[model samples]
Target: MPYWRLSAYYFCYFAFVGAFSPYFTLYLKALSFSATDIAVLMSLMQVMRVLAPNLWGWLAEHLGVRLPIVRLSALMSLAGFSVFFFTDSFAGIFLGMALMSFFWSASLPLIESVTFAHLGTQGHRYGSVRAWGSVGFIVAVIGLGVVLDWLPIMAVLWGTASVLASIFLCSLAVPEAVRPLAHSASASLGDTLRRPEVKALLGACFLMSAAHGAFYVFFSILLVDHGYGKAMVGGLWALGVVSEILVFMFMPRLMRHYSLRAILLFAFSCAVLRFALTGWGVASAALVAFAQVLHGATFGAYHAAAIAAVNRWFAGRLQARGQALYGSLSFGAGGMLGGLVSGLGWETIGPAWTFTLGSGFALAGLLWLVWGWQPGLGEDGTDRPDGGGR
Candidate 1:
């Protein structure tokens, strides 16, 4: 498949998330639901993701037909999320979210494998392509927030469904990618797990991403409470992603000289600072905007590094599974836990305390990477590291 095709597809898919993340809880709040209920509902997606990626990745690895799985899941997701239009009852929303989450989580790990395959040795371009998804997110969130000010908030679901429908078409078109393979799957899984570096890499991702739990669940609401308008909400989000895009554009050069571990280390440091500042001001528009810029390093750089690490560690049959492990542990398990904790924590302890908790998570990740995982095996690109593939 063409790079633009895959990028556009991912962009559309994530745009749905952009719309959902900022406004979904607000929609529930409008219905008079409690904070706990809102958190549970918002967190259902992460819960579903915890195991779904591995299940789908296993299928793709064994069957070697990622596109088929991607398309099937996309259809299921569309059918699932579309139900939100008909009702606002807790049960209705619960079922709809459950179905969508179960299906939606299946796509990313598989897509990451496909993306790296297409990028070949220049896998650093992964960020530039992936950043388009961030762009799509910015466009959707900003546009939909304004739309909601004038329209029924539930319209977000219908609009998201349409974008998801486009993603389904792209799923059908994305070509199968070639992954390095060994014959037996069981041995590959075992070998990858036994690698010390794999363990450390997974640990680092989990810690850093756990810190984002607060931001995802409450950042917009926090802004709204501080007297920011809907348009400002979108502008702030767009600025963060704009910074992410800039980082992605220069990523290939960074990877050329710096180790993946080094990039990730820097991302973790930025995460610490970013969350600290976020937890501190929130009332100061300038401070909040500056914190958002750090998003480029925290999420953008961290993701590029993690994906590259997964690509190097997993050979052939283990490729999809490697990415799946990262998703399940980090975005899936970590995201769910973070959202659940923050959802209630935000209400109980307020923004500062909640964000402080997030900062701790990021700091834990930074320390692990700095002290435990050493990627100093090569400096001139002539040698392969012990925990990596060539």
Candidate 2:
């Protein structure tokens, strides 16, 4: 099944994410970009995700060859990122971030589709494999934080480029999984998306992610402003991912007893609490640490459950496009709006209030789900008396 090859792609890909997510704004801040400007550029990254994945998904689903497209996308991501090495000017860096994000965003949804195919009937074990990406994120975030203690903050670019290069190399080792033929009665993409269940799911996903905008863009900066060291900031970031990894490890068990609906509801509820604690508890390290622990629910459980839900909702020929839609709508649209609004909030109301605003989005999602979401089965409708661990 080329499992390690697939795992390598995830590992390298998220290692790049780890280096960027917690640290990139610090780099931009060092470059003298305003908080609003930083928010725009960061949101620019999400904006690319909105369009690029669907574009790649159409090509992959139509062309019938996923690996070649994945390889090309990885290579192009590296090329797009290289412009950062030569120029740090706002215009150049902005273009570089946008271009790099376009190709980079194209990789994940396609890779997710491929992973689900490889898992076949054992899809519940997705967390075990995905945990490696969290591991990679922890490693990069912590290691680079230590490195930045002595080196220049711009060193993040070098680390990020290295990981992107590894992603390209890893893509070379993996082959495409065989997709099932479309059933004669399979619904069209438009029709599937039109379903009430689908709309509610996507809308909830969007609002939940939008709630994360302030944290993803400014969490580290906020900590720094509160007198936390870069190393401590990295530790806090790793703590969240470490909790996420633990959740991923136990997801099979959780899914066995709980519906996707429950897991998602739990995630939304945790997010509301997590962001608020983060906003108001900045002066209390223990309180902040407790909030970070909720990341296990917010991102880890929520994402795994959402992916599994999307996998169940879209099968066969609709696989790639369905996954792409999840990314485009949630991370792309949700994240962009979050970043933009958080920027305004950060500039006007301040960080604590801005994060409180995030909590409001999550609360909105939780309420929406309670009103709309119904219980559902595992993707294939199989209850695993024996969990799918392989």
Candidate 3:
């Protein structure tokens, strides 16, 4: 299955995220862009995620191949990102981010489909293979933080570009899999989306990611505003992912013992608390640390659970589209809304209230999930105990 090669792809892919997520805004700040401008620029990526994945997914399904599309997307993203080196104007930067992020967002869902196809019946091992991505994230966050302290913020451009290049290179080595899905006579993608449970799941995912927009957009800026150093900010970012890595390590055990619904609910609960602590507890390192630890639930466990549900629900020809729809609805639509509103909120109300708004989104998502489940249904909306959704 070329497991290490797949792992390498994950590592490089998320290394790009780790670099861009924690430090890119700081880079924008160095360019003297306003909060709104930065928010718009960042949200542009999510906006692309909203549209790009579906397009690429449809193409993959049509072509009956995934790796070639992934390779093309990675290459385009890398080429697009290189534009950052030549321009600092808001218009140029905006165009570059838009072009690059469109392709960057296109790759993950396809790769995920490929990875799961390779895993076949061993889906539980997804966490173990995926954990290296967290490792890469930690390395990038910590290393870039130190470099930011030592070098200029512009160095982030070079660092992120380097990782994008690596992503393209790694995509080249991942062999394609041709796992034919067992089709059902009556099942279709539209039917799956129409199911009440599916709607609820996607809704919850959207709000959950929306709640994260503030943290992704402003966590570093918040810390810096409160007198934290770049290196410490980097360390804190790494700390959260380290906590996430621990959760990933134990994910198989956790999945065996709990329903996906329960895991998601728990993640939402942690999100409610995490954002609040991050917003209101900046002065207390211990409180902040406590909040960071919740990342184990908020992202790590939640994502694994969500992916499992999607896999179970979207079998056969709809697999790639299923993952793409999930990404678009959650990270795309949800994250874009989160980024836009948080920017306006941060500008008008301050970080405390802004993140408080985020907590509200998480709480809302939690409630939405609870409301979605029928009184006696399982994860797949079946009435059997073995369904494990209840």
Candidate 4:
């Protein structure tokens, strides 16, 4: 298993995210786009994920190969993003974002399936390998932040495009994993989705992503409005991921001691506190830093546990689709809703209230998880007859 190569892919892939997620909106702002317009553009990433991942997953499954599809997606996404260099008009930007997003969204889920397949029985080490991505994020976020202070905002375009090229390069080096044989009596995808625990898991994931909408769309802008510098904005984003890296490093120990359900519950609890502090505590630097630290629990631990759950629940032939479905519902559907709602509410309800609403979404997810999930469903699904474990 070319572990370092896979790690390199994750690093490059998330480096693009680190560059784009926090700074791209700021770039849009520099172009004098309104809050509504920026929101619509940013939401395109999530909207395309809703459709693209499932479509790409199906194709990969049909072809019985993932690496080729991953390579194609990476090439297409880079091509799609190039349109940004030539056009600043809203219509052109919108088209570019849509095309970029459709292809960009296809890579992660398929790669995740590949990664897990390579891991085989060593799935607990996923965090250690995945931690490189966080390191990449920290590098890009802080580096770009400092650069933006000196260079023009167009530097964001250049930096992101450079990373996208790296992603394609890395994709070329990752060898495909052997696909597992499908069992004749394996439960259909529809049957798997019908399970109560699966429903609760996906629902909670959706709401959790929704709860983060404001953070992704406006947290940097929020800090800037309150007199923070661009470099500081990058530092804060890096600080959150730094803590996330710690969580990922320790995740093997965490998995040994805690149930996936327990980790998820704690993560949701932190999300409530994190978003609230981010919204209401902007004036207090200490409070904001503390909130950022909670990112370990909210995103680092939460995502590790949630994706692990998806991997366990959706086994055998359904693996790729399961990952895609999880992405579509949670990050795609949920994030789109969060982005759109925050955009519409940013001016009307104000930033504080807008983020508080995010807290509400997290609270809803926490409650749903607690009420809907049964205890003692082991990670390998040993507790239930259907092998449905939490």
Candidate 5:
């Protein structure tokens, strides 16, 4: 695999997200959207994510055409995003985000599976290549933050659009890896999902991620209201991504030292703690800044472990579908639930208590996996390499 090209692909792709995630709310506000309206619109993207990835995965698997699907989706995402520039009406924005997310999400799981397919058992090093994405995210967040401080929020969108275009160009540079054919060493999804352990792992991920809704939907507004300037907000967000990048730089080492079970447990525990601090620490920049660093464990480690778990749990043609399942269940359903609940709680209770609820969810997920998950050894059903890395 040409890792530099693949990593460049991720960096450009995620740079768009870093810009979009933090500023889209501001854009909605500029278009005269209410808080609830912004939340709903943002949640719609998560909805598409839930509905689209599995279908795309199934298609990619059956057709054996993962690269074309990725490229086409990137192109469509660029086109769909243009709709926002023409009209800011609720229906227009909703339709546009739906179209973009539906296609935008079609690519990642397949790309992940493809990258790992190219790497085989050496997959743990996925982090080293992937960490470039975190760097891109940091640069975008802080750069746009400063830009937004002086310019219109709409400029952020344009900036993000340029980045997405760059991602499309980079996608073209990623040479496709040969995927295993449908007939090769197959285990159907039915066979994979039938196992109690797989179900339990998915369940844990869904519950914990769903719990994180409060922070995602309202964290920025909460900080802004707390008197932090746009630059400070951007800096704090970059701090989190910086930590994530650092972890990715060392993720293979982390995997080598820990079991998948241990990694999951630690990641969720960090979420439990991070959200608790973030929810109530609005008055303390230091507290919030420190909490942001936990992104390393909460998101970085957890995601890497989850993908590795998916890689191990499914073989051959089922790989793409497996990664999709993990994304749909966790980021999809989990994201919507979190946004909805946070929107509700932000108006009624407050940011602090809403985040407390997020911690509860992570804690529940941690507990579930700690007790319910036990992998069936390996192909030999014996102790393996801890299923640690690529």
Candidate 6:
């Protein structure tokens, strides 16, 4: 099944995230960019996701292939990012981010579809495969943080470029997944979207991403503002991912014991607590660390279950678009809203209040799910009233 090859793609893909997410804001801040400017610039990644993935997904489906498109997207992402080396103006950086993100956003959703295609019936093992990406994230985040301590901030640009190049190289090794033939009698994509459960699921996913806006855009800044060193910041980021890795390793067992709905409910509940602790408890290192540990549930378990649900519901030729829609609505639309609102409020409402606001969003999602979602099955191959199985 080319497991390592698939894993390598995830590794390189998220390695770039590790480098970019934790440090890029620091880089912009070093360059004298305003908090608002940094927020807008960072939000470009999510903004492109709103449009790019569906476009690329449609193209891949049309061509009856995915790997070739993924390769092209990686190559273009590297090319687009290189623009940063030659320009520093706000407009120039904006253009570079937009161009890079448009193509960059295309890769993950398609690759997710590919991975599931390869997994077939053994899909519960997805977390074990996905755990490699978390490993890559820890490596890049910690390594770059340590390097940035001694080196100038330009080192961030160089480090990011190196990982982006690695992504293109890794893309060359991932073979395409075999496409299943469409049955003419099957239900259409419209029919699937029409289901009340699908609408509620997507809505909840959007809110979850929105709730994470402050952490992604300003968490490092918040720590640094509180006198935490850059290396320490990296370690904290790594700590969260370490817990995430543990969750991924055990996800197969988790899938066996709990339904996707239950996992998501638990995850949303943790998100509320995690963000609240992070916002109000930044002064206490132990409190912050405890909050980071909750990442195992908030992002790790939540994402594994959500994607699995999407895969189950979407089925057949709709797979690529289904994954795309999940990315677009959740990470793309939801993240963009979070970044923008957090940016606008970070200075006025302050970090604590901004994060408390995030907690509010998570609470909304938890309530929405509890009210809108119904139980399906238990992992024991029996229907249960509480929604128990994968």
lDDT of 4 at 105: 96
Q: lDDT score of model 4? A: 0.92
Runs of candidate 2 exceeding 4 Å displacement:
376-390
lDDT of 3 by residue, 106-190 (tens): 9999999998888887788889889989999999999999999999888999999999999989999999887655544536788
Per residue, candidate 5 scores C-alpha lDDT tens digits across 93-199 of 99898888889988888889888888876877889888888989988999999998999888977998899799889888888887754443345678668766677
RMSD, one per candidate, in order:
2.4, 3.1, 2.3, 1.4, 2.6, 2.8
Residue-level lDDT of model 2, residues 140-256, one tens digit each, is 999999999999998999988999999999999988898966656566777767766677788999998899999999999999999999999999999999999999999999999
TM-scores of the candidates in the order shown = 0.94, 0.96, 0.96, 0.98, 0.94, 0.96
What lDDT is reached at residue 66 by model 6?
A: 90
CA lDDT for candidate 6: 0.90
For model 1, the superposed segments whose C-alpha errors exceed 4 Å read 181-187, 375-390
Rank the models by TM-score, top first.
4, 3, 6, 2, 5, 1
- Which portions of model 5 show Cα errors greater than 4 Å? 181-186, 375-390
Evaluated with TM-score, which candidate comes out highest?
4
Residue 87 error for model 2, in Å? Answer: 1.6
Candidate 6 residue 343 C-alpha distance from true site, Å? 0.1
TM accuracy, model 5:
0.94
Candidate 1 lDDT (Cα, whole model)?
0.82
Query: Residue-wise lDDT of candidate 4 within 9-48, one digit each (tens)?
Result: 9999999999999999999999999899999999999999
Question: How many steric overlaps are in each model, in order?
Answer: 2, 0, 1, 0, 5, 2
Candidate 2 versus the native: TM-score?
Answer: 0.96
Question: Which pairs of residues collide in model 6?
Answer: 259-388, 377-389
Q: Per-model C-alpha lDDT, please?
A: 0.82, 0.89, 0.89, 0.92, 0.82, 0.90
> Which candidate leads the pack in lDDT?
4
Question: What C-alpha root-mean-square deviation, in Å, does candidate 5 show against the real structure?
Answer: 2.6
Q: Which residue pairs collide in model 4, if any?
A: none
Query: What value does the lDDT take at residue 293 in candidate 2?
Result: 94
